[model samples]
Target: MDIAALQRWLQHAMTIEARTSKGIIRFQHGSDYRRFLLRLKQNASSNTLKSVKPIPLIRGISCQLPAGLSLEAFQGQVWLEKDCKISVRPSPYKAKTMDNGIPWGVQHIRAPQAWGTTTGYRVKVGVIDTGIDFQHPDLQHSLLRGINLIHRGRPPRDDNGHGTHIAGTIAAANGMHGMIGVAPRALIAPVKAFDHNGSAFVSDIILGIEWCVRNKMDIINMSFGMRNRSKALLSAVINAYNAGVIIVASAGNDGKRRTVDYPARYPQTISVGATNRLRRIAPFSNRGAYIDIYAPGDKIMSAWLKGHYNEMSGTSMATSHVSGAIALLLSLNPGLPPAEIKAVLKRSMQPLRSNKARRTIGELDVWRMLQAAEKR
Candidate 1:
């Protein structure tokens, strides 16, 4: 978009923005971060906080945490003996199309609906998770240059199946087999921050978000989350939003009801909950004030290990579905801003349940969202 138009859109969004979900917090030692959060119930302000835990190595090797706590908190914390440093060197490689992996969601893609009238733009979407399988047949054409924000080494290439799977969901092509993506023409800028264990440092994801801003990606798909909140992480989202990037993230699989998952729960970020095949919300899909919309997440079909496709379930999958949809939206009109994209998603959403202040949003209707955007 041009300078004057960008300024006008920003000015408009500043006036109509809605309130953000609160009670955000973060802690690592995993399952134990909950009670530790209770200590800060009275002062959940975005201030410095701490939690201390014994490292188990020496039976009493302890680490200190932030100041206050008390409000449900984190899960999935682990201890690895190796201490490694990953670097941030740009990659010189470019992707080449292969013939093995199949498209994951082509049949239901909405891109063709607007084919006759649009320029069919290629949007830049950043996938900040495990590395993507750049050479996968279904993804190569849509893949673009990316950054490694996790291990100082190289974005730990998809030793784990998580990142690759999510990438396929966002931009995989449709000609071959598998299912198709919502936006097959979108370009992917993969940024890896987590290793196979689905584990990562808070600082790593922070660097990933910054990479998205500096690169000026149109959308960022974050399929990971922490039950804990970090000022640094939240700031990164705000910075990226101001620059026009839509941040979509998984509503952490905390198994709790109506909870706040960092990055996903961040005010500027879009949080996605999971739904099963029957169009019902997944029972284990975490819920809370932060959830912006729910999508088909259970047994979701997408690309996986060794350039193959399979079904997996998680809020992660749901997040990518929405990201892919956004890509389709941008493909139709390159002029939409991040905030306006959020508005389009919210307005197109059907009411799931109504609270005094707001109604929970459910699965997205891709065609409806695009139709609404065009009319707007």
Candidate 2:
């Protein structure tokens, strides 16, 4: 299982699909590669690194998944471990960043369509990530009381630029005054869990969920993820779901044909995938049963620090769009329960097939979602 040949084979297979999301491929190459992979696994020791002998490095990416069950996919691409399984991590946020300056992503707009109806209805949305820059003119306007849950004894400043980009997508100010968020009227309750590294632990995320439940945040947006599955994170999400808060998360960036990242893949969580302006899923967006919705993510331009903006992309950004949409729905019907909100979102889904839209989890008709909530 040569990594270069596998990538080439995967690339060739991907081109066959009429629908391509950000260059991801489903392995139509049959079991030949799988058989080769099996052989590699059989010869490998407790150390797949020793079995492979040499590890090829992906330029600019300093991270590596261990050999063995974790790096199985890496066999074909020197980047992967020798026939080993890998825990998912970081996601395409780093990979997409490498693409820098692709025009496919533009700044998300603040939802005037939503504000014209309800003024956020006294609801609050919690953003679990690096702390928000409360002083930023665009975000400060709608930010509520935020918490720094990082136990590292440092303030939640977004040095990695991941949190800032996500915040802009969820609730940037409306109008040409700045980039508009999906739900302009919604207030964001910032929860600083990930530090400047754009990484956080499951324990920290669960703790953030508890904080959200305590603070009564109506909706929670989690744009970060861990590679390993944790019972703690799942329990916390279930608890939050029971507490009447809507949680939206990214599907992850593993680039795998079938597997999904946890939290997003958590059965009840509303896992989101990324789509471009055309509404087609992004290539890096992980797909499978867990994916529930799609939104603009590829090459998206959003608020960045230092009075700037960036063209960032990931399912994380896509999750923010869905969160913003939830915020809009919440604004229209302020008292809607969490389950009711989920139901309305499902009912109002317009269907993924559209002319303007090339792809979608399903079309979510915001106006219709609000109408249903009103009747309920």
Candidate 3:
């Protein structure tokens, strides 16, 4: 079965369960997935593997394999396919926000002053989360045609409102009454990986990243994570980085030092933790060596469902601020590579006053970033 056919079948018949099912598996690449399927077909006589059906799916993923396939058998086969990584049902990071009269996130990031320089025009960003509200007045003008990886047949619409909030923070237009985003003119490419319930498998996220890479997105903001690392996930991040896409992700909300989430934990990506108006790290923001910087996330007001606004908090929100900052930087110097962009961000950050002596870089300084980008 091809992916579209399977998707059509799924849309009409069965729902893909989030957890406790091992029927779904994602491989390192399309060739690896195909090779594994070929092995299954060739070795159909084996007691451990009785099925040999084929299905082409997104980003090297194959889902809804024949029921009753042995997990142990599948694992045994993948263990030998050393070049490939296979995983099932990797959980998603939940959104873990503040306030100035001006909305602390924007003010703390110094976005208003930076807007005097540039509003991130011509910079395209990909928001990889639970879809985005393409029609929200505050964000409609900044959006590009995006894909819905969760339900491949549908338009990428924000059902859970998380991606909308994230998109608004990154690039919502400067309307009369709506809260302004950090980079108000940046274009958002909504890559809906997570379903409405804020849940997704690693495969879903990989597909989103793949779409971002294919479209040559300048930046990608991922506000979700899984505690356990998946090799396939790491490969996807690396691929995007190599393609010159600046990737930013949320440090998980586990509130623990030395335990940031994967993709965030991956060194190629910039991992962000949350801070508040006082320049103090939020208690819920995970810390450790993996956390590259902090940004305003507490009680942040941004576009929500149905053209409304709401305040939310999390490293997820913090991640969007950094993403927007990168967009602004890219708008100034579109040629800046991921490593140089990260270095500029680290150099321009204002250290959190509350965490003095720890040398932690606190909130973003968008104005400073603008100055630095101009030199490039």
Candidate 4:
């Protein structure tokens, strides 16, 4: 059937109680998978992909299923070809980033002083979150072409506003808007793996990391997490780290003592937690041995959706600060590998004694980090 015919059928199709419209499926790493894809490509037209081409990053293919076929039917067909792993995209989960009030986080981490050394110039930072507002004044010029896994043909646009805020924290320009990022000159590659509601599947995140690897991003910022750990997710993190990409993720907002969220807990990522102006860990920030660092995440002001600025708080905000700081490090030493960057950051942190909870490496100190970079 043709694209028009597929669309017409999609609009009216209902199978076993669910709308049979979209699907996300992946094949294992093997030759049979490639052959299957080639066959599918030969038989299918371009429009079958509602938006972008089937991404080679995670070896996953996304498309609107043909008319009269439910998502289950498509999965079954793939299963017939080879024993592989496949997952349907999950509903958007609640994210950790939130509006607090004011933008004091920058000074809390001493980013202004570090600005003299480097503003993350020439660094490529990938934000794997909700899409970004590329037209936002603070981010437009710094944005590189990004992919939208949620909506293929569409540009990675910020309908949810979370990704835009995170991007601003990392690379928003120091312009007339009165807002500045830790790495104001850094390039942002916004990979929209999550939907507007802040939820996404493990598969999308894997693809996002692969895209970052393919683009040679120096730092990839992820401000989302889940409780359960998946083997596939761990493998993806390992792949990115092995590729020399610095992976940073939020520790989550669960506020538990021994639990940090997956991807963050996976060791390959720098698990970040949130701290307030008082230098106390936020009540909502997750804790555990996996928590590698802390940063200002309370009442932090940055870019928002629809050409606006807002204050939000969460471990998500903290993750952005670390990402930007990593970018700043790369600016000074572009060849620094992921391990060295983490080491310098650890050595430079301002150790804090927190009675309220177990601390990780302590609060971020951009000025101190710069000093370490200089010596190296």
Clash numbers, per candidate: 31, 24, 9, 8
> Which 10-residue window of candidate 2 scores lowest in summed lDDT?
54-63
Give the winner by lDDT: 1 or 2.
Answer: 1
For model 4, how does the per-residue alpha-carbon lDDT over 177-209 read when each residue is reduced to its tens digit? 457788888999999988766777666777888
Task: State the lDDT at 232 in candidate 3.
Answer: 62
Weakest lDDT window of 10 consecutive positions for candidate 1: 54-63
* Candidate 2 residue-wise lDDT at 38: 53
Each model's TM-score? 0.68, 0.67, 0.79, 0.79
| Candidate 3, poorest ten consecutive residues by summed lDDT | 79-88
Sort by TM-score, best first. Answer: 3, 4, 1, 2
Each model's Cα RMSD: 15.4, 14.5, 7.1, 6.9
Off by over 4 Å in 4: 1-29, 42-55, 58-102, 356-360
Per-residue CA lDDT of model 2 for 1-376, tens digit only, reads 3644543343343345343221111122334445534544554553422322211111101112222212345444332211212121233333222133212232222234446775454468888887776555567677877777655465566656667777777777735455666665678888887766666644456667877888889899888665556544565687788777899888886655466677787866787777766556667878755677666677776777765666766888878877887887776666567667767766666555445433434634556667777776
The per-model lDDT (C-alpha) reads 0.63, 0.60, 0.73, 0.74
Ten-residue segment with the worst summed lDDT in candidate 4?
80-89
> Pairing residues by index, what is the TM-score of model 3?
0.79
Q: Model 2 segments beyond 4 Å from truth?
A: 1-111, 119-121, 151-155, 174-176, 353-360
lDDT assessment of candidate 3: 0.73
Candidate 4 positional error at 83, Å: 16
Best by lDDT: 4
